[model samples]
Target: MAEALLTLAGVHTHIGQYHILQGVDLEVREGELTALLGRNGAGKTTTLRTIMGLWKASQGRLRFEGRDIAALATPEIARAGVAYVPESMAVFSDLTVRENLVLGARQGRLDSARLEWILGFLPALGKFWNHQAGNLSGGQKQMLAIARAIVEPRRLLLVDEPTKGLAPAIVQSLLAAFRELKATGTTILLVEQNVSFVKRLGDRVAVMDDGRIVHAGPMPDFAADRALQMRLLGLAMEAHT
Candidate 1:
C-alpha cells in the first residue's frame, strides 16, 4: 500500500453551535483514490471542508505529507498543493471558459503543455473555450469546475459529488476523465453519493454517518458486503449499481 498522504485523527468541527463532525478519523493514501461515502447530512461535505480549511477543525489533527495543516488558512492549504472542487460546481458563471482556466493557474500564468494535457482529457472545455461558463450545460459546468482544479498539477484533489445531476452518458464521460487522472498518480479524496461510481473508481472506501466514520475498508470488501451497506447507508449497493 502507498504511504498515507493525508490523515485526520479524532477531528471535530462545529458550525455555528451545531456539532457537524464528531471525532472523525480518516487516511488518504498517496497516489490512490479514496471515496468518502454516506447518506445525506453525514458530515461527508464537512470533512472535505475541514481538510481544505474552509471550516476550522475545532479539535484534533489534519496532516498532509507529515505536516500539520489543521489550522492553516484555505489559501495556505492551496499553496501546499491541495485543490478542492466543491459539490456545487463553483464555476465563475460570468467568466469565459478560457478565463476560468487562466485564473485557476496558481502562478498567474498557464503552462501550455499542461493546458494541452487538460484539454485532451476534457475536450468539452476546449469546445466551449470562449463561451460564458453559465451558458454551458450542467455537465459541462461540472467538467469546467474539474478542469479548473487540474489546470495545474497538484499533490491532491478533494472532489465532492462529481457525478451529481448528470445524464448517464455525461457521467460516463466524466468517469473516463477521472480514470485518466487516476492513471497519472493524482491522489484523490472523493465524496460521492453514486454507489456504482464509487465502486468503479474507489481503491479504498470510508462510510460516514452522524459526523463520524462508521466503516472503513477496501472498496471491494465494502461493495460486496450487502448487509453492511444496508446497515450503514440504509440501502443495498447493488440496487444503485
Candidate 2:
C-alpha cells in the first residue's frame, strides 16, 4: 500500500459565522487518485479550501508529507508543492492562454519540458495558446485551467469539480487528459458530483457529509454497493448510471 501523502485529522473550519467543516478526516495516498464525494452542501469545497490554506482551519491538524501545515498561509502551502484547481475555473479571462500558464510556474519561469508535456495531453491549450482565455469554450477553458496547475511539478493536486457544467464530449476529453495525467503518477484529491466520472478514475473513495468524511474505502467496492450510494448520496445508483 502507498503511504498517505496528505492527511487531515479532525479538521474544522469557519467562514464568517458559519461552521463549514465540523471535522474532516481524509488521507490522500501518494501517486493515486482519491475521489472526494458528497451530496450538495456537504462542505466538500470547504475541505479543499482549508487544505489549500484559503480558509484557515479553526481547529485540527493538516499534515502534508508528514509535516504540520495547518497554520501555513496559502502561498506557503502552495510553495510546499500543493496545487489547487478551484471549481470556479479561476482563469484570467482577459489574458492569453500562454500568459495564464506562465503565471502557473511558481518559480516565475516555465519549465519547457513540463509545458510541452501538458500541451501534448491537452492539445486545446496549444491550439488556443495566443487566444484570450475568455474566448475559449467551456471545455477548452477547463483544459487550460488544469494546464495552468501543471505548468510546474506539484506533489499533490486538490481539484474541485472539473467536470461540472461541461458537455459529455468535453467531459470525455477532460477525462482523457486526466487519464494521461494519472499516468505521470501525480497524487490527486478530486471533488466531483458525476458518479460515472469518479467510478472510472478514482482508485480510492471518501464520502463527505456535513463537513465530515463519512465513508472511506476502495472505489470498486463503493461502486458495487448500490445501497451505500443511495444512503450517502441520496440518489439511486441505477437511475444515474
User: Per-residue alpha-carbon lDDT of model 2 for 1-241, expressed as tens digits?
Assistant: 9999999999999999999999889999999999999999899999999999999999999999999999899999999999899999999999999999999986888888888888877888888889999999888888888998888889999899999999998899888888988999999999999988988899999999999999999999998998999999987546666
lDDT of 1 at 223: 90
Q: Candidate 2 lDDT (Cα, whole model)?
A: 0.92
- What TM-score would each prediction reach against the true structure? 0.98, 0.97
Candidate models: Cα lDDT each: 0.94, 0.92
Clash pairs, model 2 backbone: none
Candidate 2 clash figure, as a count: 0
- Who wins the TM-score comparison? 1
Error of 1 at 4 (Å): 0.5
